[model samples]
Target: MRSSVLALLFFACASQAGVIIGGTRFVFAENKKSISVTLKNRSAQTWLISSKISSGSAWPGNDGAVRPVIPFSATPPLFALHGNSENIIRLVGSGAELAQDRETLFMLSIAAIPSGKAPPGSVQMAVRSNLKLFYRPADLPGDPARAYQALGWQRTARGLTVENNTPYFVTLFKLSINGEAIDNPGVVAPFSKRQTPWCQASSRCQLSWQSLNDYGRVMPAVVTSVYTTSQGVSSRVITSASPSR
Candidate 1:
């Protein structure tokens, strides 16, 4: 019995480590039938893989209240993976109409459920991985790559004002004003605005941002001149670390 429990523990940890997900993030653009994600199990034990999709910034919890706005389905919802095996999960959009002006975001959860019962008195747990899914509308007004260009930054009395002039979302990974780092990075919704109180009063301060790349990885930070040589805001921008609108 002791040996059985030890074996279960070893396999549980090994199986979790062996699961490999292909990308840090995924994009399902308009006009594409579907996209495929490859999941490989390198452990000696079998894994029962399952998936579900949820919408917005919130991921689906134990409760089933969350629903997907831009519908998508994961094929092979439940599958068994033997040792050193791989499976492809297809994400297909439902052809339902969504807002064409901005991008919609979702979350895809992939769970690895171990097979067999735990040792009589031992506990078993399933390992889970989450990835962001971006649904880009065909008619989105501007290029997401240039979203930063349209962002308007102004020095306010209390802090900084960031205005989004384009239809794309600007996801901030790291933001600093006058060399002071912001507490938490945030997202500026399409054509929206955000204010950061980095100082008590306005000063001749510089601004910079580190954002997400296409792979969902954080890119190197870039210093931005909030104003052009003519003291006007420029219409050129940079990229960052998460899915964009």
Candidate 2:
């Protein structure tokens, strides 16, 4: 008797399987009603593509709870992407009243499932690409390119606290504390603060971090020193020189 078991695999990045997304991240300006994202399939097999917009609160989890509907929608949410063909997916907004002074964040998920049948006793893989979608208002007060340098750092009793006073979300990566790498240095939300337990309270150490721009490119590293004093805690920038790309 033939075995009836079928295996399924999930991938976070679809580029390895021949599907190329046009951009790493997407920004939806408030002045515009919608935006278009291009997807190209380089594989020889046709695939079923489906897209969705969500708050991304329940991702990487198997909870069966139903999620609330978001204000955005993706047109032609489900379609067949033929091999070596390109298609455009339009993301339209419903003019929901988000934070006018700060940018709101969402998630766009694109899943590609193989249309062809898998070989007997083989596994069928499905690739899911999750991209950050930011809704930026028309008139933000500060420059997004230089917002990373304006982050406020303080040495707290628990650890190091990074504050974001700007209207744009700042994502930090390649973070290091005194030449020691910090794992999973996360993003600081717009007008919010995040604390990480990477540095001690009463010690002086060098901290380095790099931020991601709107196009998802990593900018140059910003090195600074975090020192504590009798009055309180403070940070001083040591270097912010951009290296040759």
Which candidate leads in lDDT? Answer: 2
Task: Name model 1 segments beyond 4 Å from true.
Answer: 1-16, 59-68, 118-123, 139-141, 155-160, 176-184, 195-207, 224-245
Candidate 2 vs. true structure, TM-score: 0.84
lDDT of each: 0.69, 0.77
> CA shift at 106, candidate 1, in angstroms?
1.4
After best superposition, candidate 1 residue 173: deviation in angstroms? 2.2
Q: How well does each candidate superpose onto the true structure, as a TM-score?
A: 0.69, 0.84
lDDT of 2 by residue, 18-112 (tens): 67889978999999989999999987878899999987443221122234357689989999999999999999999777778987677899988
- Clashing residue pairs in candidate 2 are none
Error of 1 at 234 (Å): 16
| Cα misplacement distance, residue 186 of candidate 2 (Å) | 2.3
